[model samples]
Target chain A: MSSPLYELGEPVLRATGLSKLYARRSSDTRARLGEVAGRVLFGRPPKEIQSLRKHEFWALKDISCELHQGEALGIIGLNGSGKTTFLRILAGQILPDGGEVWINGSSAAMIDLQAGFQASASGQENIFLRAAALGFTRAQTEHRLNEIIEFSELGDAIAAPMSSYSSGMKMRLAFSVMAIVEPDVLFIDEVLAVGDFRFRQKCLARIREMRERSAFVFVSHGMGDIALFCDRVIVLHKGKIHFEGPPKEAIEIYESLDEPASAVDTPAQLTKAMGPTFTNSGALKDVAHFWCDESGAPVTNIAFSDNVHLSLEFTSTVDIKRLILGVPVWNLNAHYTTGLSTQLASEELSVRTGERLKFLLEIRGGIANPGTLKSMMTILDGAEFLYRNPNPDLVIENAGHPTWGVVTIPHQWNLIERQ
Target chain B: MTEKLLNTRKERAKGVRIYRPDSRIRQNGLQAVISISREIRNFRSHITTLFTSDFRKGYRGTVLGIFWNFVLPMVPISVYIMLVSLRIMPRYEGLSPAVYISFNVTIWFLLTGLIRQPIQVVKSKNTEMMKTAIPLSAAIVSSFAQLCFDTFVRIALVVVIILAMQAATKWTALFIVPIILSASIFCLGLGLLLSILNVIYRDIERVITILLQYGIFLSGVIFPLASLGPLVSLSAANPFNVFISSAREAAFAGSISQPGALAAWTVVGVILFLYSAWFFYLMEYRIRGSSE
Candidate 1:
């Protein structure tokens, strides 16, 4: 959706060499005391004059970007990568430690959707309250009242107190009010996934319409939404820009970055495994977990379009009657992409003591959503989980896929002459 | 957020806002005055909304609604009047014992209300400050307006009592106007400073609350500190005593006991108000940082 106004090259928002410094928690008390003493003696603190100080680390360093009219810029990064900090600086919530931000026209931020709604007040009264909080006059807010009510789809419920409304209804009201008050520049931070599926689609369409008039700085972790809304993307890593280019290429780079070791979904206490020593009913220890090709040779990497198999080996200490193996794969975002289970495949087997059992699970269609995926194996007896690998063993590597979602299906597209 | 109030040549030419490191709003006292005036003028509507909403929200579910503001102050004044009628308290300021105690307790409530309510007002609006760019001055002014409204209601009740008791009226009673204004400005200045500090160290709130619980006894409002002999000079030095004692002397008697102190403390009030406003302007960023 690249309109001609996007080619006008008129920069509406610009940031250059922005940085923020935060004192370490251990030294924060001493620094705060010094700051208070300085303020008491001399009007302003010396820290404001000389920004850099010891025991302080940069949250964002030397980040520069420019957004033109009718363009949506996406910022993608893992948690604690300074994405929110950067957005707050741009939105004028906090001043930067270094560098400057220039806005050519009016701006608004959707950093927090439900920022200033009074619970004791009725929804109709709160519209005026929220509008005043946004620095709009009562007359101006009144002009858009009907439209906001309609967009929120809260016909009779608008007269009810805000405290009585459910959380989803509150979110609907907040999103509708913010959407109606259009500004020249809009800074949105991961607020798109609001309400249910149908309402989320409505919000996306509304955002698309607003893109024609306002320049946007969008931050989100969902790659699909980024590809849909942003014309270009910036990938940040550890308070630095790792890559900046088209959305597809930026997504690839973001996926290829190594997942942090202490990522979510790992168990709290990991049981160290020396090797496979399964008591069948007591526990199942994994010796090796890997991916193999059609010829059954272990491979470190697998392509999304290739045929592959996942193999696991274990040695049993006792005879097992009914065993179930379940493997679940999780993407870097901790989103469960896909799973495979032996019970679903209807394969029943028994293992005896001192027998080394090898289970081979064939991938009929290769796993999609290219990235390094983490998979953990679970051994169950009916509804009871006998053993679970505390640490994910199988790491699936699929790099540089063009598609943008978690699953891919083969289909054909043809144009029929029915019309 | 004060950067938006800079509203200079750049703002007039289509609202091009610029944010940079250490963008101070004031370079001098005149600039600080100008910036505050500009902020007040620009956000007057926001100030009105916030004030009305605050007044309404305080007594939302009650049957009496805003009348509570009128009746709540009467409870304490009624207790003081009962004590005066019971002969437990002696006459103060050479007037009728009941009238004197009524005026003293009413003025006392006005003094404490101005100085104490601001910490609660500004602290509760901390969330509103973080989420919106509504100028901090607007919130403070709204708080000042609500307190003024409550004070006016109580002052009206005191005026009625003065008429009903048929107390001797003096031409010097007009002096109470400036005395009340001086007290308001002085307490506002003190309140503004305490509210900001309370955000940084909440201990200020707990300590101020405890001190205020006993402040009435020590401020010469209910008891005549001068008759205590030893506390005479201390009472004269206290601004709370200066304002309340000056108002009593001017209203009932035609002359003031300590006119020079009243005039000097009025100047101090002006200077304190100016200094505290400037300090609040400069420490805006630090206050916002610590509030979260």
Candidate 2:
């Protein structure tokens, strides 16, 4: 995520031990009234005395980070890990209870994309309204109006009231306006989770183009996006910075901190018959799932160039015929990455009841897309699923090339001069 | 954070903003007033833009559009004049009943508008202010601008009536300026205070609505409060009563009763405005946080 344009040492944003505390108990109206009454009767006692008396816990505690120009910083964490609290403090939307944050230039937080839009106003009017909210002058907004309209691809719909717009169209207009504004520092919280695939790609490209002038602080649960955008990543755990450095190593630590993936109890709907003729005769249970390298030792992490041997162990409850194994890989966002199945295999196999079978599906090279990937093992007889083993996620550590999409295909290019 | 970096010319050029636990800006009354003035000035464009949109949105689908500003007040004025002419209500003294009722009713509308608009704006805009960087000052000012537009039109209508009646326009009538200014400042102060409290207490808006419904009768918009006996002194102490009645007397007859009381309340109004604005600024973040 680094580039030659990055001013490596010129930090535009700096935070020193920023922390925020939230009251565990709600500060009810009665308590607030009593506090006011006490102040009026006894006069001002002291600062922090009342707050200290209340039950409070720090949502963020002594966390610090710095960002230089043209660099993007990624923050990733589980729920309640303080990622959002840290981002809010840095964005200046919420003040930290302790410590200091200094930004050398203006910053804009795209926390809620449609925050200021007027439902009854037309898209054309709303663009100006949103521009004003962003502190843009009329002249500046006018200058960029045509480009924004062209980028949004709203065309005739721009004249229609925003209430009539589909949510995707609204997101397009909002993102186009913000992306065009180009603040000195940008704080984005999961805005890319919206829009279609094409629009998201356009937004990412726009952000990459804006990197020359802006530094980004991005918060997302998607590891692929984190690896794609951030030059440095901070993994927050329990209100503290548990890991910080390169995206790859930080992601590794973040994944390791989570409880290892365990077997999900098979839902009843999946075990139901797909057709009237099909009956629930047998079920499969996952015993072991892991990936290994050429040495045949269980490898918890796999690199892109390494030969991948996906080993799975399962036992069937009844005798099954013409059963084929299906291995489906999915990214953390539940996006299908790739499908590896024995459906295309020429040979079919049969298994007896209570027989424990181990199957290994080997790939010449590892998955190109990098992130923590989950795999489901499905034993299919034609179209009906006899057994589905979906537990124990497969983690892909690294990719050889920076690419977009679920899986990158092996390809090459050759230069030739035509006579 | 070093002092050099805090306010240095180079840092200013880069727009360095530093926030700490005690980073709240400490300002006295005069400084707070100055800061608020500067913020209003810097956001004047936002004020105008929001004002134009809000004003237009008020009458967007109507046939008459801006004329409703005049139409709304005329209905009340006409009804009161008819009642007075029909001998159903006591006549307004010292001026033509039509002129007096129309003029006083216009002023009363202005007062009611000043009292009512702020709470509505702050409530409707609670989401916008909390979710975005739009300053509360800009929203307040823009809503004030709409009221200003309406008041300007109503005053124009009053002037036309005065010209048609050929009443002697006295030079001393200029006293109405201070009367309106003081009243506006006082209502704005009270409105702002209530708007902040209204975010935490949902009943404040309803209470204000009920109070305004009874305010016109108590203020002697149609007839003198002298008939009410004990309510005369009671109305004198009421700022709305003092300002409206004083303004009416000044504009129609060139003299205001209880000038000393009006002056005292004017001073009070100025102090209230300053304190309320300062209080609003201090509680701004807290109010926004609680608005959700």
State which candidate has the highest DockQ: 1
The local distance difference test score of each candidate is: 0.74, 0.74
Evaluate residue A122 in candidate 2 and report its C-alpha lDDT on the 0 to 100 scale: 83
Computed on C-alpha atoms, the DockQ of candidate 2 is 0.37
Cα lDDT tens digits, model 2, A75-173, are 988777888778877877665667889898889988788987878778988888888878887788899999999989999999888999999999999
Tens-digit lDDT track for model 1 on B1-292? 5676655455548767666665554345456657777888878877777777767777888998887867775778778778768865555666666677778787877777777776776677665665665667777788778767866776776778888878887999999988999988788777777777777667788898888777777777777787668888786688888898899988888898888889989999888877766665655544454454
**How is the predicted docking of candidate 1 categorized under the CAPRI scheme?**
acceptable
TM-score of chain B of 1: 0.87
> Mind giving the per-residue lDDT tens digits that candidate 2 earns over B1-292?
5776456547657688776654433544466667677767867766766776776677766999976756764677778778888864434665677777778788888777776777777778765775676667777788888777777777877788778866666676898897898998888888876777676667889998888778777787776778778888787688888988888778777787789889999999998887777655554544444444
State residue A295's C-alpha deviation in candidate 2, in Å: 12
**RMSD in angstroms, candidate 2?**
5.5
Going through the candidates in order, their DockQ values are 0.42, 0.37
